[model samples]
Target: MPTAATVPYKPANRCIYLHGFASSPRSRKAVYLKDRFAKTGIKLEIPDLNQGDFTHLTLTRQITQTAALFNNFNIPITLIGSSFGGLTSAWLAEKYTQVQKLILLAPAFGFPSSWFHKFPQAELKQWQESGYKDIYHYGKDKLLPLHYEFLRDGNQYDTNKLKRSLPTIIIHGKNDDVVPIEVSHQYISSHSTAKLIALDSDHGLNDVQEIIWQEIQDFC
Candidate 1:
């Protein structure tokens, strides 16, 4: 039998990365984090929430799908979620005690209430009546059809109130147009244990990749 000191080493922690809406494991941010963290003996798991079924993609369904993957971790895990994925991570962080920390990037929390106002009243009415509407997916480079049910699902998960005691770090851009910096501020205000890092970049935050990497490395 081999002595404990001579045994092969194993990483004690896991990293589960949840991608944003309409995005996949192939997203630039996901790949970048994977490459950076791999050198430290950490491999990230990025799940495809859509699972080849975009028609039924809702925030609730995505949460369920992501939870399944996260629940399998027997050791402590750090969750890194971006945009819509950030919202999903909130729900998981609230439910799973195995998660040690949450890192959210421009989380699209508190968005539904404001987004509904973006479309004209007539367009909104038509979408509601039609049951489904086409929306452009930047990650996929294709127009995806989403149902109104997604909004109904979004209403159920309030990121501000979920796991308010969980340790969290939020990285948000001051110039974010999609989710807005105010929302992230509000989230941090409500969650006493959460910290916010405000940057001058846009929602993409591509310009500050090195900074983000350093923060993550420090946190891990």
Candidate 2:
């Protein structure tokens, strides 16, 4: 990943980059993309999705927070979201017409439900019964206590509800263990205006940032 100081500057275009779950604006991918956009003289607005409180994080909060950024612009803006943020972007685009374009990276299409199968039945039950579960926070480099309300809130969002069609591109890793590429495949099948670019990488997609950038350039 490129290590460069994030220089504050005026934005040449209306573009927002939303980081993944348990991540901050300073994530490697966020910083890398910020640097790339800076090189193009474009300032990418990255909001700290954590909101200084990851324990109480939920998808609804992410959507509400990100929506506030472009709500009053009264103009179309592009959105780039990764993982859980990607899911948030899709929901935002569905609800708000201001989101004109979307660039999703390994979007968590089927989330809380998909997660049910990943963990053991006993573990899932314990999480619900205990009211909280400890998840490894990538940005903090430690396990953090996440409230069970997160899962409860996520259940309200169904990927099947996404019916809005706009200029959208999804870049997903073929070997993604977190959110499977099949999810993107299913997503593309429904939306006629969306396309999928499967790459040879994992969930992080760090090794293929250049390729991702190139795709973004072409898409934009």
Candidate 3:
């Protein structure tokens, strides 16, 4: 992906692009989606989740912040989110009928247990004792501390409660290590309106942006 890109004029109907954990609004994917939408005269909102605060970083807080930004706009939205952002998007669509369409890119759903299990006993114990652990921040080019509360907050949300009414599509990497494709499958099993497209890729799925972008165009 390009290091940077330019965004043009805004449009009435907007789309929100929520980045993943330890990511930023300036991420390449975020800007790519922003620049792409700008060409179609559709606005994109990419908020700063960290915003100088990492002590209370969690899915609930992120979702609240995103909802606040989304509420400012009166128009309906096409919600697109990556990883943890995708999980947030799913929750938002469950509560708000204004979300006209929803698209998840390798969404991090049902990962509370998966997260805890991924780490060994010693590492998990360390994370619990310290209350936080440093993870790579792709935007800042360094390791940033993420509070353990992030996982705790994620666990509280039951994905099975998702409302099956809205039109939603999930694109997941079959080889995703962070969030498995089976999680998305579980999400799809609940809703007939939901569709899952499993691609032969990894967690990033950066290699198939063209195909995913085409699907996004077709979806809208």
The TM-score leader among the candidates is 2
Expressed as tens digits, the lDDT of each residue in 121-208 for candidate 3 is: 8998999899988887877888878888888788888887786456788999999988989999987887888889999999887888
Compared to the true structure, candidate 2 yields what TM-score?
0.93
Model 2 poorest ten-residue lDDT run: 1-10
Q: For residues 1-220, could you state the per-residue lDDT of candidate 1 as single tens digits?
A: 1111221223576788888888888888888888888887778888887788776788878878876765444566678999988888887777766666899999988757765877898998888899898988767889999888887777776665674456689999999988898988888877888899999989888888888899887766
Question: Over 4 Å off in model 1, which ranges?
Answer: 1-11, 71-73
Answer with 1 or 2, whichever has the higher TM-score. Answer: 2
Candidate order by decreasing lDDT? 2, 3, 1
Residue 220 C-alpha lDDT in model 2: 82
| RMSD in order of candidates | 5.9, 6.9, 7.0
Model 2 sits at a Cα RMSD from the real structure of: 6.9
Q: What's model 1's TM-score?
A: 0.90
Q: After superposition, how far is residue 118 of candidate 2 from its true place, in Å?
A: 1.7
Model 3 compared with the native: what TM-score? 0.89
